[model samples]
Target chain A: MKTLFDKIWEKHVVESITNGPDVLYIDRQLIHEVTSPQAFAGLRKRGISVFRPQQVTATPDHNTPTLNQHLPIKEEASRKAVEALRENCAANNIMLFDLNTEYNGVVHIVGPELGLTQPGMTIVCGDSHTATHGAFGSIAFGIGTSEVEMALATQCLLQSKPKQMRITIDGNLGKGVTAKDVILYIIAQLTANGGTGYFVEYAGSAFRSMTMEERMTMCNMSIEMGARGGLIAPDETTFAYVKNRKFAPQGEEWSKKLLEWKLLFTDSNASFDKEYSFKAEDVKPFITYGTNPGMGIAIDGNIPVNEPNVKALEYMNFAAGEKLLGKPVDYVFIGSCTNGRIEDFRAAASIIKGRKKAENIFAYIVPGSKSVEKQAREEGLIEIFESAGFVFRQPGCSACLAMNEDKVPAGKYCVSTSNRNFEGRQGVGARTLLASPLTAAAAAVTGKITDPRELI
Target chain B: MQKLTILTSPCVPLNVESVDTDQIIPARFLKTTNREGFGKNLFRDWRYDSEDQPKSDFVLNSAKYSGQILVAGKNFGCGSSREHAAWAIADYGFRAVISPLFADIFKGNALNNGVLPIQVSENFVQTLFAEIEKNPKTEVTIDLPAQKITINSINLSEYFDINDYKKTCFINGYDDIDYLLSIKEKIEHYEVQKS
Candidate 1:
């Protein structure tokens, strides 16, 4: 009995050592500025080169300035990181997508949109959001910097395989529910550490019905819940999305790949170490009020009365049993590996269209990738955003980690579509309320946390 | 990597739950490549006031507490995958952190960076916190080879779990790269076979 995760993991196993971790071969590896420099340094210390430079792709995303991206990055530490990446990639013969390149964007977004992430491939990145690649039925996960060095030096990782978990969401999704809401609800129910020892497979009707971009959003936050990664079985919807992507296979190779991908689903008799079932009706447009993703509640619901909730509420200055429905929002940020796709933009832009951004709100509409930016412009999404007084900035992880100049001021509240709501995640003393793009859009227009369903 | 077979130190209790990596080392400090300087910015937001002055109420700044061990609330290191959190802790002179739960990536990062993340039971953690509250300078000993953490003042001892592979690395001060090099031939052989 082979589950989808089992099949993918087994096929990639290069050597299994007794009482030790499996030596798994990597099919593709993504490197970003923040994590790769130290790995390259370790390699130099050992007098070793990247084992398979062809399979490695380097990009500078985390440290790149969102605005004025064409000019030199101004922040001293941020500039050094980007420059080090440029120099290292050049010296190591690794392909790089630097700032201003059409291919330049967040590493997670650029990889799949360019077709580098494919089904049945074992993908790894130094960053945790690498799990986003699992939307295509691939076994993907994040690694530490030392593991990045290991992957570069050997094209293999000594990894202890994680146990399997199957999370099945059945029934139809209610109105205003998005892939983001479903995940937030799961994390809330499961808690941040719920999936710590498992690799989750999102299955059944709800996940099957999600668009590729939606699936990507769902998998992107898997790390937030402490899961090594999450994956979905690739079907026709996945194939269609991968068909003409820039790096996707062409001609006869496409047909051959499609046939193999179609067989990637879990067998009926396959057993998982643990299983969970949830109803799509139970999921609603959600928002996190506290410091962690797990401290989320429904749009109209009260915060849970618990010890963690008490601490989180104290930090957030929110009272338990007090409704979060009308809390004012100061900033609205829409971008990250979590919800920066074309679909996310469409959802936000549709809500913002024909209405101006609230005067009290500073809304930033950032696309995930340069490709996404181009598509948004061609589709006039950018025009709608700009006309509504929202700033449509160039693609980088702006205001997500606040690595650049676009930081929310201290003590301000931001309705962000990013993955994490950790304390001071947006900036020092800045509070983040993680929400779907639609929810953020709703807040942007109303200057408060209004349910997107009310606006829709 | 530092050999961590046995460590004895006082504990600084941070009772707040789910202390994430962002709280440990803020993202603004993650831009630099050098790992050593991170200690100064460890818990940058919490340790300092808006004016960049050290807050007297913060545990690290208090005269009553001084230790190489941090006894924290559950779910320590739960956010980003930045190893700088571990670097900050190690650089700040903490040899070990005892918690009821730890996020997986952060635990791995801590281990690789020579900061021991010792997972004890919730009751044990609460007891440690209470004991630390009673006496901030109470000493605790962690024996890595025996997988035991002993709170000397409380006369309590608990065993922790670590994989043999990691345990070997921890005791010998070997990093992942060191192990990879030791098994370089095996990696090369498998790569050739796969190709």
Candidate 2:
């Protein structure tokens, strides 16, 4: 009997170095402008082209401005990075979804929607959120520039097999709870470093009931909790989500892939290195008070008074044991690779449909991809958000990171739906309260930390 | 990559827990194409204020501390997989980082870039911090072949873990790309057989 991760990992192992990392053949390598430049430079210096160009995909997301697609980047270094990616991808024959392309978006979001991410595949990217693709039952994790260069030159990465951990949530989730809340709750319970050396497999009724997009949100934050990646077993939901996408298998190949994917589950008697169980009913719309994701609390809960988080609390201008309710929110950004899918916007719109954004709050909604942006436009999400006074931006990883111009001003508090609430992550001296889009919408409406359930 | 071997030096104790990569080097400074000259901006926000003045309170700015090893709190390098953090550490002249725990990606990045990440027990880390704070001149040594980290002031040491292959690479300055390229045919053969 083998765990789901062991099966996928073993299938991809070309050779194992004695007492060392295995040479793992990567099925897909997603590259972005920020981290791929040095790797491309390394390839150029070595006088080698990408070994398996067809298996690689490149995108310029980290530094691209959300508002302008056609105009040249205003920031000099950012323009240079995007241009470097273009030159490298073009010269190496690697496919690039450049700026303004239909697929140009966050690297993690573009892969799944385009069907480049598949079950039983080994994927690597230079961005930590590369873990987002594990929702499709793939072995995806972030790598450094050297490893990126190795993948480019050999289509393989030398990786050690991470220990397996199975986290089970048996009961049904309560109202107002989303995948973001579930993962946040899990991180709170397990602490940030609990998953440090393991790859987690999310199991049980709670995870099974989630849609592909929601599952992606769950896996996207796996890196936040120190896990290499998190994955769920592929089922009919996974198959349907991947069925007719651009790069998914077709006809006989689809049938063959379906059969292969059906066998991607862990055996009944398979044992994990560690196991933990939580009731789904225990989850609520959660939010982080400290700088780390693991310092989260339930929507109506108080900040823990006893944790070793004095520094994080000071950075956020919060006191231990203080209630976060009614905390003023100066900004509300409801998008990221974590929760930037159609369902996430639907959740946010469900709460913001008939209400006006608070005059004191500046709100933004950035779609994950060009297709997602177009679908939001078609489905009236953009109109609904605009009508409520929320500024809807074009696709890219906007505001979630401080790379581009959409930075949260210094000293302002933002209720963001992005991962990682580290100090100065959104901007220098910017305080981030990580939460779900519904909660962010509630904050946008009230200009304060209000539980989304109250608005509902 | 430079070959990482044994060295003894005084420690720079950050004393902060869960120091994320964003704090190590902010995202705004990551746009460069080359991997050189990141040392100046390492801990950019912490080392300098809004007006680019060095914060005298920061550890790196204090004249009392100078070392090639960064002995920090637990769970160091816990967020974001930017290899830039490792690059910054290596660029800032830290040959090794000793912490009670390390995040996965940062550990790999450090190893790849010739910066050693030494994972010690929680109690040992606490003792090391206490001993170093008591005397800033306290020296520490990491012996690669023996896999032992010692606090010279206390004359106490504990064995650390590093896989044989990585140790071999550290000793010989071997590149992972070279190893992977050596087996490219095996991988292509495996792909063909599977397809």
Candidate 3:
């Protein structure tokens, strides 16, 4: 009996070097502005071309401004970086989803929504959150620029197979608890370094019940807990989600692909190198109080007095044993690869409908992709947000890493729905508290950290 | 890649935990296509003030600490798989980083970029910090061929671990792309068989 990870991994292992890393074949490659420029330049320097250009897709997300997609990128450096990507893609004959294109959004979001990320495939992107695509039962992981170039040149990566870990969460989640909370709680329990050198497969009833989008959010933060990547076994939820997307198989090809995907589950009695089980009941709507995602506690829970992460505490301006409930917040961000999907917007709209944003809160509701933005508008989540005094912005990796104009000023507290609360992540000296979109919505309405269950 | 084997140098100690990539090189500096100038902004937030002046208290700014090696706290390079973090460290003239734990992607990036990421025991890390605290001039020697690191002043030595292939690459100054391109025929063969 082979585990799901082993099955996919073995298929992708092209040639294994004795006592060395395996040359793993990649079925799909996703590239973005931040990491691909250097890689493309390396190719140009070598007088080489991409080995399999058709399998690769390129977009500019990290530095793209969320507002004014029709206008030229204002920052010269960012403009050059993006222009370099476009130039490289054109030269390499790779597909380009330029900014303002219907398919353009966050690279990770755009991949799955377009059905380019399929089960049993090996996907690698330069960006770490490439794990977000693991929701579809693929062996997807992030790579550095060097590996990016290697993949671009050979359509393979020289990688050592990581140990396998299965994190099982059972039982139904209570109100206000989201996939983001479950992941945050799991990371808190495991610590950021606990999953180092391992690829995790999330199993059991709770993960089985999460929607494809929710599962995307769950696997998206695997890097935060130090896992190389994370995935879940594909089921009907997976098949239904992949049915009619732009890139998904059509007609007779669909049945053949479905048969292959249906077999993408872990066999009975297949053992993982490590295993941990958590109850969904224990996972509450959580928020991080420190610099790392692993330093999270449930809303209404007290910060640990004995926790010795003094630097994190000082950076967040938080004290031991202090409750985060009702703590003042200056901004609320509800977007990123983690929570920038349509359901996230719907969830935020559920709590924010007819409620004006707090006077002290500058709430920004940005979609993850152009498709998600269109869907939100179709569902009138934008109207709900705009009416509630929350600014609705276009899609990009905005405020999450704050590469663009959407920044939280220094010494300001923002309840963000994106991953990572590291200092200067939102902006230089900006304090970030990571939470779910619902929790971010609650903070936007109350202008403080409040339990979303109260509104639910 | 520069050939690295036996190297001796004093180390810079960053006594901070969970030092994410954002801290190593903030996102604002990541827009540039060129990777050479990142050293100037390495740890930009911590090394400089809002007015763009160097912070006197930061380790890099202090004359007491100057080294090609950076000894950092646990879970170094935790967030964002941006190779720019490895670029900034290498650009700042740090040839090696010693830590108790390293985020996986960062370790890979560091190794690929010719920045030696040496993972040692927690106790060993603590001892090194203590030794450095007592004497800023403490010298650490990384003997890559022997898979060992020695603290010359304290006479304490420990055998570190590196993948045999990576050790070979370091000594020979080879990169993944070179190996991959050499096996271009094999890759093409595998693709044909799979299809």
Candidate 4:
């Protein structure tokens, strides 16, 4: 009727009988080491087996060190969490992608690359960035431990459907701009909570121009603005990306599946609850000034100093008005499910090819997946990074949320590509400025905040 | 060990819109998995200044009202899937969070931690907000057994449909594991039959 999102949501809703919550069938349940322990424990304590083991997939990513897959985890708590996942998966008859396995990496990265994440599937995970799966035109969102248990026991979730919003970005992106910048710009235009009750569909000329990888990066960040998730209609770019993935349809079946996926878009007369549009040219590489993603501004813009409110000023540590340029930085972290892909690396490395690290800055470059790491290394991107004094770490969620030893010291200012600059997301007392990969790299090399376009 | 009983007082109105997870528990405190002491840091950044002093702007810092149940505006707990946010809310002494809407993940975490998340109509939410504005001491009652919430002398009867199994465990103060342990005899019988 409207789009696949509407169709799938309507079809899977078990019932709404009179006045009640709708029980929605979850088509896929992805788990990772960091959040699944308590969920698995809940299941065992209830004496319940996973209702649909085939629908659930587990991986060890967050706490797994990227440096060496063979080296045992150094942190005791991290090691314990990883081991617990292995043991839990074994006991529950669930599939696990432990470190050193071909399937190991960020759950978001692994799910799509393996073809395990497909179009029109409702995917749930214990991690918020689960919106990454929506790139394939699916309705995906994160669930908590109890919900994970509920999904495990029944393969269904009691959900109240979210409102729908379509954000259309038209025109062509200027040279040097990427999908990361587009989403950052959108967040800047709409405050962090702008899309609170809506599932956003990204459409128009700009979105259609994006490659599947680019679309994935854009959709991966839908949660930043409080959207339930983001999606792009399937096109040739989507078909091509899934064609050879590990789990996608094969041989003669692939062509037939492609034909069906082509129908995933909204009809010309489809309606959305709300609509907004922006020009691609207005988008620029952005960085956060306040504690949230919506508080970002273009790299070239001044930190707002003239706000009448004291809370805004105090939260951002900003004076009345100060240019962000040349502001000293203490750390630069470039990795997360959000921007850890090869394209992100290439965009960053291209800007830092001949650059030297700032005298006072500490920089770390962590890839999102082993596959991305291998690809970057094969292209000699590792050498370029090492030569620039950037630490090339293994594939895992590194300083994104500071789960392990990777943390910024208290009160230090950091420029990161990872989402959420909330107070101490990187570490207790560490002030974070969220930006795109290129912007983070530029800041790392300069030892100060600099616009990525200047480096280019 | 004694059973964990959360005796909630009449619901105290919060009346703020889009209360995100960051506002519940700032992202800085999410590093640890241990669900202890988060109540102090709950809304730490929003509730306090850099000098560890309380911010005058935050509602929690206000001297006008204080109680266990929180009545908030639309879209409460809108960011991050951090259980710490829920733990912080519960530990901070909030027994129920009433809003027009709640983020799916945040709602799940609240239920698991024994903090009830009540979804009400927008008109009711507005009425609650107005009442609280008129009198900060306004109170509402939430009777979990009856699955009903009463505010401003208006009774809003609603059913929170949890998993049938989870509902039993919660009412009995048993977690999933405790429920399973209690059924060990039956499970053992079934195992014997299979063997």
Task: Highest lDDT: give the candidate number.
Answer: 3
The ten-residue window of minimal lDDT in model 4 chain A covers A14-23
A-chain TM-score of every model? 0.98, 0.99, 0.99, 0.96
Q: What are the per-residue Cα lDDT tens digits for candidate 1 across B1-195?
A: 888789898988788888988989998888877667889999888899999999987888888988899989888888778888888999999989999998888888888888988999999999898888888889999999999999899689999988888888889998876766667787677767855
- DockQ in order: 0.65, 0.92, 0.88, 0.21
Candidate 3 lDDT by residue in tens digits, B1-195 = 888999899999998877999999999999988767899999999999999999999999989888899999999998899999999999999999999899999999999988999998888889999999999989999999998998899888898888888899999999999999999999999998987
Compute the interface RMSD for each candidate structure: 1.4, 0.7, 0.7, 5.9
Give the candidates in order of lDDT, highest first. 3, 2, 1, 4
The ten-residue window of minimal lDDT in model 2 chain A covers A304-313
Return the clash pairs for model 3, or none.
none
Error of 4 at B129 (Å): 8.8
Q: Per-residue lDDT of A262-331 in model 3, one digit per residue for the tens?
A: 8898998999999999999999999999999999999999999897998889988899999999999999
State the lDDT at B37 in candidate 1: 81
True contacts kept of 1: 0.57
lDDT values, one for every candidate:
0.88, 0.92, 0.93, 0.77
Better of 1 and 3 by TM-score: 3
lDDT, candidate 2, B1-195, per-residue tens: 788678899999998888999999899999999999899999999999999999999999999999999998888998888899999999999999999999999999999999999999999989998998899989999999999999998899999999999999998999899898888789889999879
Q: Residue by residue across A112-182, what tens digits does model 2's lDDT show?
A: 99999999999999988899999999899999899999999999988989999999998898889999999
Instruction: Go through the candidates in order and give the C-alpha RMSD of each one to the true structure.
Output: 1.5, 0.8, 0.9, 5.8
Please give, as one word, the docking class of candidate 2. high
Which residue pairs show collisions in model 2? none
